[model samples]
Target: MNQLQNQVSPYLLQHKDNPVHWLPWGNEALDLAIRLDKPIILSIGYAACHWCHVMEHESFENQQVADLMNEHFVCIKVDREERPDIDHIYMDALHQMGVSGGWPLNVFLMPDQKPFYGGTYFPKSNWLQLLNSIQSAFQNHKDELQQSADGFAANLEDKSIGLYPVELNELTPIIPEVLAKISKYLDPIFGGIQKAPKFPLPSLTLFIESFPEKLDTNFDVYIHSERQLEKMAQGGIYDQVGGGFSRYSVDSEWFCPHFEKMLYDNAQLVYVYSKAFQRTSNPLFEEVVNSTIHFLNRELRDSSGLYFASLDADSEGIEGQFYVWEFEELNSIIPYEKHAPFYQAFQIKRNGNWEENKNILFKNHSVLNVVYEKELQTLATVRAKRIRPQTDTKLLLAWNAMLGSGLVQASKGLNNHKFLENAIALEESMIGFWDIKNNLLLHQISYSNQPIYAFLDDYGSYGLFLIHLYNETAKVIYLEKLRKIVNGVYQNHDQMNYLFSFQSNLNAALISNKYEITDSVIPASNSMLCELFFWSGILLNDVTYTLRAKDMLAAVLEQAAANPLYHANWLRVYSEWMENPQALVKYNPSNYAKNELPQLRVTWVPIVDQSHAFLLCIGDRCLSPCESIDELLNQYNSI
Candidate 1:
């Protein structure tokens, strides 16, 4: 074992026994690079990435390749989940280098940590050739390489420097046009954008569902939402036996998945499907929501109620080994009487849909008619005997917060008290990490019980979770906690207009301060913060939070205008900003069931307060106080 044996990150630990001397990204590695005047081979990936595993086996574990890497460069490995701040910096560098970014990110940087060349996975021979070439270039042409690195670093810094200030007036008129452009990519049949690899772009779907008024008359957002939800639920990307969704589908049909389950993805998905269930009263959506929550509670949850980061795709060193099954194996496991229905329901074929006669179970027929719970249980029981995939046990604050918030939303939509109970438990557990004196949260609790400083996403999502809890329970303490977190986040920023992805003190080793604007697999932290600001402003009647939200939206208006889908979360914030008559309803706790408010079905009604009477407000204007639920509903409808 090397230096990585001392690290807490699961991804780093996976490489602890590798021949390559892998150092975790920190001052030691950086200092070594500087002292030796050696270029750095920085590799970034997560535990769940299949290609990352493949690359590790192909080149990193190979003795010849390890010797070359050790002799020529200072090699650093980063777990993207644990250190997304580092990933963002280098991924942005790769994009700036005009390369499309993906997992197993291999970038060769100068001793100063400026990336001059990079690419994704390469075969062993190619990797060896590239290493030799890079070493040669560093030795023979130092000046040219330094000039290129300097130019790249300068360009990267430039992206963060200038901003064209946008006013609220300029943002309103562009909404309709932005929505129209976004709709052009929507797949009428399969529901996501017409693309080969389909992701359940939750923010995009949420934005589409949130603002139906902005969509063209020809486009029905519900149809798109329903189709997408149904397809994903029936797809192999979803664990039909187990609950929760895989990362993304490799094919447009959603039948082939990458097979890693992430906390953030499932959390966002739970929110998405729950909203769909509420809007359409679809049983399928309700089932997906329930099963997903079950999966989280069963598979991902720690004893303290915090969710783990992810479940790896590969088990026993083979991709999809744990998930797929052979036709003969299934027949032998399941009884003869139940075999036909089971095979037919899951689209299990003798020929197999995946590699080496192994099938990835998907609903080829109508999902509505199928009820294979017994069969699924049988399969699950049998599969449990096999070696399970490695679970990345680190508890991430932002991801757990997302899941907690999602549980609250799901509970409301499904009217399931158990979900709400789980949410409350999760919230309680997450609160333990809060440093009340410092007014900040720890980013994650490692398996070894080490605490890392919180990043922007941790503050944004956790703060939002607190706000959600406040709305649900009408507890003033959560609101107070949110206020402190908000204050702490703003204290680090030079300007309150936009928040950076990493906190100021936490980002000492980063090449540049990054403001994450575009939504990737999860919603952007800046966008989540904008949502937090808008809601908190109205709930607390604070103008500063509201005004700052508008300014932050304005700051990203140009980017939102350019690629609205990439900035889908920003559009959700913009939609909330533009669409007014946001009903802030206050009611007496004695008059109604505080926990079970059917009125929450209305997404616009964000704030709920317990008082002697019910009052509805739209921005400063207030309706006359009502005494009962009926009167409150009538007043809300009239506006």
Candidate 2:
């Protein structure tokens, strides 16, 4: 029987039938281990992780492993996604233990539920040996094991939970300084930040774009940002042969990719690229955004407009197999007439662009840039014929909401009606389909299917998305949905005095009493929640939500004040809060329904209640209800 018989997470349910009598992490499991005086074996992984699947098949499925686990220790299974707080605590433990960590994280905890030993996946033979060795140590060196566990527990307790804040004034000047410093770090001959194994730092690129707004309008800053953006747009990091970006390049020149593609990266990159196009009027940047959109539509997005998580780095048991091309293969596939144009567009050479005569994808002597419109169209058609990698179809709520927000932003920036439409459709899917009758979000939805219950981050992000979608379309329904969800989140998750936990039920896994501000694969749930309260207050004319927003910020203000640069998300929130807030309220939803508004250069913030009064410095501006839609629009735009 699997350890996850009655568990909530689908990932945990997958291991229920494994030979190991794996116990889900809980009080009962911990209590049993404590009573038996046995070490706890905690195995952590996610549902879609490929290597996690491999380890299960190789070692966890074995009867010998199960027998050893049952007899020698308490075995526990943890789904990293379902319980990130638990994952964070253990990951920190592994770091302190001087061991590298990855999924499935194999950690041996003491009876008290503190990790004393851990490593990632080990071969089945090696794993069996390890089990025997650990069993021996606990039996023969019981005192030694107790001492180590006690020391580890003490060290963990000593680690501080206090937050530090970075000052906004200090950050106001640092953007230019960082831009200059970053310009020096850029590979001049090739585009990208520094040397090989180039991860696309979309954040850095966007920072460079915003540098001028934060600093002096020096031409150097302008020119440097443009050059960096242009070079990367044309290079292999951009998927010159295909249409979308790989995760990163293995080299500084944006050549030789790591080859995985993530929906979050593409969504953020599209917003950045589209904005760059607007700022510089660079056709190449425009092309990059357009191609990336095509890639998302073709592979990433479900029918509802929510995007899937990722495409694997490997295909057919080999890394980059689906993406890499050979000279002979290219020649064999293309006719003589089209071959020259194709070669020029992709920067292909007879010697090949990568190691061992394979094209890692970069232009050489022939292709200066993808200058012609016809050329790009032709390449897109040809590239579509190639074998594509399988995509991970699990629809994560936070990520989907992020893509929804990004697509809506991009649509506004590019004046693309389809992108806006896609955003609306996605919002409907999340609100109408994913929400269980229990008034909570489902975290993962199958591709082209209905969603499951949502995570803490889901409601927070979706709430924010609803607000943004309202800004885009000026639909009352969007705002109304946002209000309902925000109220639901506050009532369901909030504790007294500005605290919120991840789980709706107090009996569910205890995540945290305080906010976690760290930006990981997704922006922090706490940060998004803070934003929802702040904005909802402005749009609705409610003071309670606004005050609650301040309380949440104040709770962590000290931490953010101490480390402003590292707390980018907090700083972003602070910047808006401190600035003269501009509120745009349109009463006539119909006017905005068909109109294509020029993209606002400012970060468009949609606030409802009385929160806008303080930010806009328009105290009690309009107490009387406006008689007409035009009057409301005018009053809203005045701020």
Clashes within 3 Å, all models in order = 0, 35
Q: Which stretches of candidate 1 lie over 4 Å from their true place?
A: 158-162, 170-173, 212-218, 335-338, 368-370, 435-439, 447-451, 494-501, 507-509, 588-612, 619-621, 624-634
Q: What global local distance difference test value does model 2 have?
A: 0.65
Q: Against the correct fold, how does model 1 do in TM-score?
A: 0.94
| Backbone clash tally (model 2) | 35
Residue 60 displacement in candidate 2 (angstroms): 5.7
Q: Could you tell me which 10 consecutive residues in candidate 1 have the lowest summed lDDT?
A: 599-608
Per-candidate TM equals 0.94, 0.77
* lDDT per residue (tens digit) for residues 1-639 in model 1: 257998888899999999998998878889999999999999999999999999999999999999999999999998888888888888888998899899999999999999899999989999999999999999999899999998888776535521776777644566677777887998887778899788888998887776654353545556777788888888899999888899999999889899999999999999888877877798888888988888988899888878888999999998888999998888888854666876787788888988899999898654652377777888889888889999998889899998988998898789888888898888889866766666556777653334457888888899899888777777778878888778768765434335554544544546766777788678888888888888878778698988878788878878787899888888777766654434466655555556545444343233345454677776446679777677778877786
Q: What shift in Å separates residue 49 of candidate 2 from its native position after superposition?
A: 4.9
Tens-digit per-residue lDDT, 1-639, candidate 2: 455776656567768889888888777888899899999998998754557767888898889888998899999898776556577667767878998767789888878776778888888999999999999998999788878877766665422433333343344433334345456666666545676666666545554554435343553555555666666676766676456777677777666776778777787778677767777767677767777888888788777666777776666655676666677766766643665866766667777777667776555432334554455455457656756666666667777777777777678667788888878888777754344565555666542112234556777778887877877665678877777777667666645446465555432443233245654445567767877887787677688987777666666655654544334454345444543232333233333333433233333333333222212223223333454445544545664
